[model samples]
Target: MATGWLCHELYMWHNTGNWAQVFPPGLTVQPGTHAENPETKRRFRNLVEVSGLLNHLVQISPRPATPDEIARVHTREHIAHIKALSDAGGGDASWLTPLGAGSYEIALLAAGGAIAAGEGVVSGEVTNAYALIRPPGHHAQPNLAMGFCLFSNAAVAIRHLQARLGVGRVATVDWDVHHGNGTQAIFYEDPTVLTISLHQENLYPPNSGSISENGTGRGLGFNLNIPLPPGSGAAAYRAAFERVVIPALHRFKPELIVVPSGFDASGVDPLGRMMLSSGAYRELTHLLLSAARELCGGRILMTHEGGYSEMYVPYCGVAVLEELSGVKTHVDDPWQPLMMAWGGQDLQPHQSLVIDKVAALVARIS
Candidate 1:
């Protein structure tokens, strides 16, 4: 029942500058609104405040992830590039995913938190855990940070377990509404680590995750990508898990499960067209919990991914935390706002096609 929270002060140290606003913004009021640390802090604090499970949380103070630790999953050249960018000025404006002043410490803290979560799982300090890490990690590749991601946090954790803790079989499920191309690439040729990314296709990073981009060499079939179209709601995500994710895991039977948690799939979020609500996140967490209980010794580590709607993301995040910690917290309008969204702008025929296409694609895959 112990749930380790690999959180440090630097989780919110990353401050987005003006560049992200110009290219592709985040999920809040406008594109660049969610780019600020205060926005993430506001919503994240809401979830923690309501949950009352703060007692169960483990606070990992800020610290740097060593170059060797990073190299476990990322390419040395990529690391060098990011370091140069981080050091050149204060941010990385080229990709619109800039880092603010003091962001270097923040990135280290985020990376450290993920590694701490991995340790928690290995040492049996918790049945499962979630690292409320920031500077989302799914979009980061071995050498670069795209899509507001600075490091491949989940992939790095996997490498830590394999090299540092001697874990053999590891699996990561990324439900970020965008493809986890970086994670897949890190373990693309490694059979020991399995990555399952079920995302809304054609969203960001246009052509990243496709069914045909399965793993290569020894890692063949270890990487599974289920790309859902826009507007896919609770049903599609859950069905993908039951049909493809769970089945694959049940058959592969890994020792640990990790989720790159992202709430951008919520209906209110501007980055995505998915109709998933707070309730949907809870259900998805429940499904993962069930699978973990049945297969992977109930070990799960969810590192923060993406979720833009400041108002809505907190609610959805709280919902998932509630399911994970078995803590029932009551918050007002949490469920109402998202439910309201589905009925208002989400049901338009154009959006509905997105859901239908996702369903058809899943049918083809599973």
Candidate 2:
């Protein structure tokens, strides 16, 4: 079993409609352009092909998730609403989620792609997998699509593994720049799945992903949030993973590992303020891969979540896939020097203090 990659052309076409890159387009905003376009992701696919990385891994074709599979994670009402909107020639399904004609089908494909990746990992058809899906799903709540997400892809994939494959004790580590509020919400009170998110503090949707907002009820200590301050870079992220993420996974001892892979944390991303570079992403992937090997027999799956940098996301993803597949490439990140010079790559006393706070929570859960 080798590393598997799942993607579909339709994924690049799940349009999120035109909107101002920054709010209030009438004032100082560029002309309305589709906030979510296929360029960034399509370019990622192109990079992989041109760099010869695509030939090294098994490519898994995606199928649309059944309504039943979607219903396992999302409400039927929400599903109906989205389908109805798609039927009406497109509209905003919810907050940041937009759809065009037939997008409901494409969204299904994205969720299905995630499930297929999970299937490959669990079935031993692939040692591990990466589902490069779009209309990222970490921010999708059961009833609302808050962050350019229509369905909770990770949740749906997790549910499929649990219900169909009887796979148990799953851990999801979301490192998207914005909080993975929806993934956190879906498993908030479930102890079987341990949800950990390392994100920018108070960034998106506002008032979410606080460290104090750990799991509730039976899942009291199951969810962990490491909300790093803005400008946090590679060192800060490494510290958080070592102090919080790796330790939490070790303590939980999950059977399989899933990551909501988002490149929005990169220094050059338009939507985030963090300073993570391609090296940061590669190191993060290496750390998670190590933990997965130690705790779960190297069974790990990463489904693409959020990444907005059209020029740099491809390289970021290439770095991650290289580590995941154990494939080497000569393709270099052209902006590495500039990003390294952007500073914040080193750990700071203030960053250590923040990490220490989250590290303390590990003890509580342990």
Candidate 3:
């Protein structure tokens, strides 16, 4: 039986006050209406309200990740720049990412939740944990913040383990629709960590996660990219995991597993064209948990990444939690009609050939 740990900050500190409609340059914020929360943070927090997940895992209280911890992965100059922006009453520093008055504290808690979850796994407190953090962290790099991400949560946790705890070998598997360019950039030169990204090609960062751009120097063959074509579903993901991620984990023999979980791959989500259903998350969770159990005594922690659809993200997250904690709260989906409206037929050979090509590409990446 696997123990489950959760960071309790899911409902706390999410878009408390109303945000202004007008954003700074290059900032694309959801139009603020009096009726809607309008902030993605608030929308993402809907997962906490799902009774199924709220009752499954134990919520461990988390404190803010200290400045030293933040500096482990991020440049000190970049940290100072973010603080300066927040201190000057919030501004957009390119890439549609906004910083409000409480941005610093919220971002700290997000990072802290991730670190605490990692600590839980490292100390044998839990076999696997899920950190339901916000201001999703995978897109934030060493110096640039983008795609609604602030601090690089997964990178900070990995670096903390490396610098302080002396846990050298870690594996970061990013399952977001967009590539984890920030994490790849941070560990591209180091051999201590292996980064695998499964995302849409040419989606967010524009030509970022190509299979050719593996890694340089000592990190060669340590980075793997599987850019599933748009509209690839469970067939593609399951095939990728069986043929790619599983073999990579077996070869790398990581000390722990870190997942940047993103639900935007759901078919109804606006972020990507993938057609995965809620059940796919459960299978993915089970597969990773199996890997952790077989390799690292089930030491795994997943940090929330990017999932923008308010209606579907919560359900997708709840499904993963249900599978992880072994708790079935059995809350039926009220929006199945909405899903039925757009849920197309199963991924066909038109899809299988693409998946076959992806499998061959993944085989070469390994």
Best by lDDT: 2
lDDT score, candidate 2, position 366: 44
Give candidate 1 regions above 4 Å deviation. Answer: 20-38, 58-62, 336-366
Clashes of 3: 0
Off by over 4 Å in 2: 22-30
The lowest-lDDT stretch of 10 consecutive residues in candidate 3 is 32-41
Give the local distance difference test score of model 3.
0.73
Displacement of residue 82 (Cα, Å) in model 2 is 0.6
lDDT per prediction?
0.74, 0.88, 0.73
**Clashing pairs counted in every model:** 4, 0, 0
Candidate order by decreasing lDDT: 2, 1, 3
Could you list the CA RMSD of all candidates, in the order they appear?
Answer: 4.2, 1.5, 3.6
User: Which residue pairs in candidate 3 collide?
Assistant: none
Query: Could you tell me every candidate's TM-score relative to the true structure?
Result: 0.87, 0.97, 0.87
lDDT of 3 by residue, 50-164 (tens): 5646654666666789988988878788778777777777766455676666677778888988888888778777777888776678888887877667789999988887777
lDDT pick, better of 2 and 3: 2
Give one digit per residue, the lDDT tens place, for model 2 in 283-339: 999999999989888999999988888999999999999999999899999987788
